[model samples]
Target chain A: MAAGNEEISLPASARRLLPPFAAAPFGPLLTLSLRSLARRRPGLFERLGEHSTARFLIDPTDLSFAFSVVPDGASAVVRVTGKSGSAPSDVVIRGPLLTLLGVLDGTLDGDAMFFHRAIAVTGKTEAVVALRNAIEDAELRPSDLLGLRGVLARLADAGILGGLSAARHFAADAPVAKAGQA
Target chain B: MSGRMELVCPAGTPATLRAAVLAGADAVYCGFRDETNARNFPGLNFSPQEMAEGIRFAHGNGSKALVAINTFARAENTDLWRKAADTAAVCGADAVIAADIAVLDHMANNHPRTRLHLSVQAAAATPEAISFYAQAFGVRRVVLPRVLSVQEIAVLNRAIDVETEAFVFGGLCVMMEGRCHLSSYATGKSPNLNGVCSPPEAVSYVEDAEGTTARLAGFTIDRFGAGEPAGYPTLCKGRFTAGDKTGYLFEDPVSLNAGSMIVALKSAGVTALKIEGRQRGKGYVTEVVRAFRRAVDAAESGGDPVEIDGILAGLSEGGRQTTGAYRKTWR
Candidate 1:
């Protein structure tokens, strides 16, 4: 269990190559994105939240960041919690970067990653399962974690963001993007 | 594809129902919003209002709408099943596709005029079981489980009086349709009971230096190597070490594409051809329904069935396909 508070200084060379806007507030961005998703598919989180007040600690092992996700009514609240050897969470998930990306893109089977030990989870199993179901029901993507589709699309049009533009095209052909409240 | 063979399609939502109907589905089947049907994933299925509207739309287009109340009723929660049936009848559904004997009995007694079609979840493969359902519940049709071959189906059809429906495409269940308890053993949820298999909640994926792994309830079901596509980690499709060799012990990650067997199934006296995957989206429903419509029509017209092999390949599980037990020489 890597401590969240462990000081991780990026290499100077890596820092120089990083995107200038990479330091943006992911916590607020993710919260706003979740709100947007909840708006599109109302009752998605509500059904998943059913009587459970779960706090999830998501650790992307390949990254230097971790976050806590708490479902609040129809939307989820995201916080960049400290790794200060804090109290155990209701659910904890640790997985590689590619694994997380694959799950988000619907290209990787989450269960398969767990089977191969590429992903790991602990604590209240039911709560974790519920959250996973809620997310899978959403058929989410990495871009969905940021509520900047219009900006990204514009950037894509100007050849500034190739990946986001490709995603724009993908969304056009994407299946009806919702699971029912039923 | 015989002139009399009905093409039964799946609908996960109201839009899909319309897509299926407009694509020439003779009949479309769907479930109530909850666990009353097998494809009970979140964000899928029709509400009572949606069900009524979808049925009305299908009926307006001269297509029949069947309501699936197919999951087994818990000992303490039979009312849910009963309510689903009553609602279906009120919605004027052409039939109620059911698996539970209690549900069948309730539908027969409470909504006598509402036709009952036995769900594949019943796993009623033999004439005796089919006859029992027909006699006990007046079930007019049975969606035969996926374990039977074309020859076996023809034989069973001859011995049974009820109309038989067989799967022609989509997800393939390795075990006897309703009898398998693999998911329950691994995840504490069964398709027969909860109407979910490899439930999304119980499923998780992890990645490490080795590769990606699929897990169910903490048990590793399968692992994918670098750049390899990962399939859903249902217990039956998982790779396991059997003896000294490791492989898909029960079945592979391929989906059932019985497109090539439309003529054989029709010749076997199958009253209907079922295309699975109600958990899918409208794009899937639209493409599959339209393609199968062409295939069924061609078969009925005594011409070559449409060449839709690659058309559905992208939509298949793990991007591969099989005929399943339809031509089971492996057995």
Candidate 2:
């Protein structure tokens, strides 16, 4: 598990009832997904490699983890980096996991997110642009990961989905309940 | 009253351009891949080939494609703007939307036949500025800034010889289009130059046991409580600590949705209703353009405006909508 991962408010029910499981590192997960994608779309990786002239470091702010992504031949490689506070990179993207998922899913507007400051980029702007363009062109998603659904199903069987709903309800009601009490 | 007002929509990619055209957008505006246009975001806009293809697709669908080379050109990089204008003209763009004086001059001198429209980034709110652009660069229309009211727009239209476009929907820029520099103050890049505001790379959202706080360049812009929906940390829309209160000082985190005022806006002499959000996707372009098309047709035929209300709520920012400065109460 990523360091400081416990601090992030996962859906409320999950926090109360679910026990933490050992999650895999983000790098291996990303790499496996990218390799599968490259195999499916050979030209896409080449185009991405051409555009990704600089390296990128993605930081999930809620977790104590970061990743370095660089183009290698026709495919890109992702490696687990330690943290944002120490690692130096050409471009750095820091945001919440939900926002990252939203971007990958194409449901969230990256520009609007930037405008809102939910996602941030620092270092060379060109590198971030290249990465963004490549990602959008490739249209990768968290669901695109191999066997992700199976993993999710196992988690759901553990009452993860119910926990999420309970957390959401708790979050939605806490403020109103406090006001009512006051 | 005899003619229907043009419904101009935004197109970030060729797919969205095609979607807008099919959805009944009379004209679609897009920018080049670089910082030449205001909506310079990652994975958005078009390349030269994509622009040509987009133009072809739009024209085939009986719609026009307007290329936006709207950003201000640096003295050293004047050729980049010139090349973009040249490309737009060659690509058969119906119009080239520009804000810079130099870029306009280049378009006027070289591609005299290609129509020119003054960008809202110019912040040309008065007849004098509009007339100046019209006379100097043969500008056919002006995309008026967000500052003017419907009544003021009607008055200005009577004075200016050129056509006027007003924003009817999408994201709201609380500051004047071209003048705001809050992003530059925090990030090193300005919208006028880099074509980004509160750029993504400079933003970070910190979540803890208490809540989530949105930060821009290390400065905390807004803090969200446990259940509150955290919005983007745009400088203008940020909550700040005042003497005794802490709240949004400049603007709220809501989208502009003026579907209800289509008739009043048309009556105010607005020639066109421009929908912003060039950085949006085909789904957004299709939904917004289709709804606005129905709304415009309805308004022109003296029908109800509420027809589009329900369709737009899901797309609004933070699920909240406003008429913005168009309504006097918003002032």
Candidate 3:
């Protein structure tokens, strides 16, 4: 398990209910996902243009661990760590796990999320914008990360669907942010 | 009796166009992918094929599409602007909004049948200037610049022959329409020239204990305290020090929410009420258009003004609302 995960105000009933799964290493799956996406859309990272060299810290606030992704086309790897893991990423995108997933999968608007304060970002706005543009164009779904058709894909998909209610589960316990609250 | 104001909305993409139509816009305006139209962000505009499809969608849903061929034509690339105008005409755009004299001349001489609306980028604030466009090019309507007060617009409307459109909501530029040099000075790309003020590539936010610092092209624009609503540091909204005091020297980082002035604007003989932010997402487009739809309807039916100052609170940059120059004459 990652150390020093930022403590959000989720209720005891919803917090860390997926103890075993939360402990499961997500780096390999994320790495696989990025590789699959790069393979399917060759120009995905190239669209990042000058921002290709920047490292991104993707923080899923509902989860215990965060991820650092160094996007370099097919060779990209995702490192799962705590919020305080890195010194300086080109950008830091923090939000509920499912919403972040939704943004990546093009199911949600990152701008709307940012506007609603559902997402908090710091660091290079250009890199964040580039990532958003690249992700929107690539049109990758969460299940696309697996690239499998058998039982493993089914299991991953089930987990992905279950993650939605679980995200709301965490959110329901947290204090509601006010209108235009940052 | 006051005539019902036409609701003009912005659509950056085809999905947004459909959203605006479904939500309640009488018209939606968009741009081509090239710089011939403004709001030329990467992956944000429509192509010729997409424009044709979007226009068809708007028309099918009882909405009109206004193609923005608004950017001034480069001396060497005048044909590019003409081609965009040609594509807009070919696609059967309800109107082509243009600013440059060459473009207006091209539209008048070449596509004589197509309707012409003067873009706010033209900054034709006077009856004389507006009369020149109306008489010379047969421009049917002119989008008034944001610099005018509601009273000034009321007075100007009676003197001009053409219809007038006024901005009701969304982003505000303190500059004279798109005539901004600060963006060019900082990033070397003017909204007038390149269609992007504080171009995304030139923007960055750095977070330390001092809080978030918004920068434009490596120059510090502003800093926000922890948990403060951070705003994009456009040159106009950035706080600066003048004469030993630090503050928003030009204007504060607040969005224009002119809902209260809807009835007043209608009384001022405004033909259309516009919502800005073509580069906004479908969700943004949907919510704002719907809220203003009710507001506009209320103004028509003699109901409440919809008190929309707080409706757009979450979506607005800096999370603050203002009546803007519509009420207060900053000049």
The candidate that achieves the highest DockQ relative to the unseen native structure: 3
The parts of candidate 3 lying over 4 Å away from their true place are A1-15, A18-55, A69-89, A96-118, A122-124, A133-182, B1-3, B242-244, B329-331
Interface Cα RMSD of candidate 3: 7.3
Q: Give the clash total for candidate 3.
A: 0
Candidate 3 is scored at a TM of: 0.83
Off by over 4 Å in 1: A1-182
Q: Which scores higher on DockQ, 1 or 2?
A: 2
Better structure of 2 and 3 per lDDT: 3
lDDT of 1 by residue, A36-119 (tens): 766766655653545236777877553445777777644578876543135356677875433454445444444444433455
In terms of lDDT, the poorest run of 10 residues in model 3 chain B is B224-233
Q: How much is B209 displaced in model 2, in angstroms?
A: 2.0
Give a tens-digit lDDT track for model 2, residues B1-331: 2367999999877767887899999999999988888877665678898899999999999998899999999887888899999999999999999999999999999999999999999999998999999999999999988878788888998898888889988888868889899999998877888888787667766656777677888889988765454444579888899899888889888888888889988888888899988866655677789889988998898876656766776566655678877887745
Residue B178 deviation, candidate 1, in Å?
1.8
RMSD of candidate 2 to the true fold?
Answer: 7.4
Instruction: List model 1 lDDT by residue over B118-159, tens digit each.
Output: 999999999999999999999999998888999999999889
Candidate 1, residue B325: how far the Cα is off, in Å = 1.2
